[model samples]
Target: MKDTDESIELSKRMIQTGELCGKTTTAFITRMDHPIGNAVGNWLEVLECINVMKSGKGPKDLVNLCLVQAAQMLIQCGAVPSGTLKEGIIMARENLSNGKAYGKFREMVVSQGGDLRCIDKPEDYPRAQFKADVIATSKGFISDINALEIGHIGVMIGAGRNCSEDAIDATAGIWFHRKVGDRVEASDAIATVYTEREETLNSAADSVFQAFSFSEVPVEPEPLITNFVTKDGVSNFSMSIFED
Candidate 1:
């Protein structure tokens, strides 16, 4: 919501439309400077989410972002009292750990005619024929992993569509070992990319390597959630309750 004028206008219009129908509307505005979690493709991202839901363990940033969004949703929907945002977060974490979240996901997959065998045992899923590691050239702290560049690389590796007619490869995607602000030694595997096309492997790996920027000094990671937008106004921090 904070990115562009068009998005801001659209958000305001959405809230206004909801108001006309006597509904409440709000949005959690998060930064998109880098990929949310380690995985950035269809199957790889699903596996990451499954691991998080099943074990309540995954990337710290991804977990926190999900919890915060879930808490806000609970508050807005009145499933929990507006003032109990922290409680909502705790409840979400409990659901993740207690298998309820994974259960729901499994149910949804079955209902949608998706094959549960692959999700249940991800190892059985077909592997990418080609794989390459993006190694660090110098020892330093990672200052940036440009999200735009990474997204382009995703398309190049067939993880995403280049055009409306382009087909996606479920096994093609990237797994990051080191993200922003992580220290790396020379020749360390910062990330690994996978794809079915052997010819595209080297170019994709080179692009992924170029997407990373390094600094000799430590870099502060940017905040994931930057603002909260509602019918009332925008705020820098998320609020537990919004007075109507």
Candidate 2:
């Protein structure tokens, strides 16, 4: 809801049309609080998703975000009870941990003619020819990571395509080493940039570093979930719950 006009309008239109979402079919609405995980680019996202599926432990915030979204999706679809969110989370975790999630991913890959070798051994997937770590300059908490600028860095590195005609390098991306509310030192690795080409590495490094902000004061990160908009009304999450 914070990002797209079309999404807001689509929800409104659905309600106006006949309350099809909440009444006929359940609709779960949520927005990404950050880049959505530890990975901030194309191939990086794929690898991150796979790691989460295989291990059930990658980034805590990402794992929970996915589990919460899945739980809510099940509840709204009536497959799970409204009171069973916690249980639903457990179920989702089981699916992720027990190879159920990877099975679906593999099926999709085969359907699309993607290399089975990569799916079987994703660690052997294409890696950046060059890599660099972005280290923090001070001892403090990560106050912010600019989501948009980080995305632009991916585009600059060719992980993201500028237009439909622009070819994207599936191997290029950045991996977050620290996130908001996390502590860091004078030289803690906050992120890693990956790309095959050296031409864009330096500038991309600058953008990646500039994208983060640090502070000595403690920081309370924004909620991954802001609210739930349903047929009845919006149920807002209290921001006070996170305040220090």
* Number of the top-ranking candidate, with TM-score as the measure: 1
User: Distance (Å) between predicted and true CA of 91, model 2?
Assistant: 1.8
RMSD (CA, Å), each prediction: 3.4, 3.7
Candidate 2: where are CA atoms >4 Å away?
Answer: 1-10, 14-33, 81-83, 238-244
lDDT of 2 at 220: 83
List model 1 lDDT by residue over 85-146, tens digit each: 68788777788889998999999999999999977898888889899999998999999999
Model 2 Cα RMSD, Å?
A: 3.7
**TM-score of predicted structure 1:** 0.91
Q: What is the lDDT of candidate 1?
A: 0.86
The window of 10 residues in a row where model 2 has the poorest summed lDDT is 235-244
**Pairs in steric clash, model 1:** none
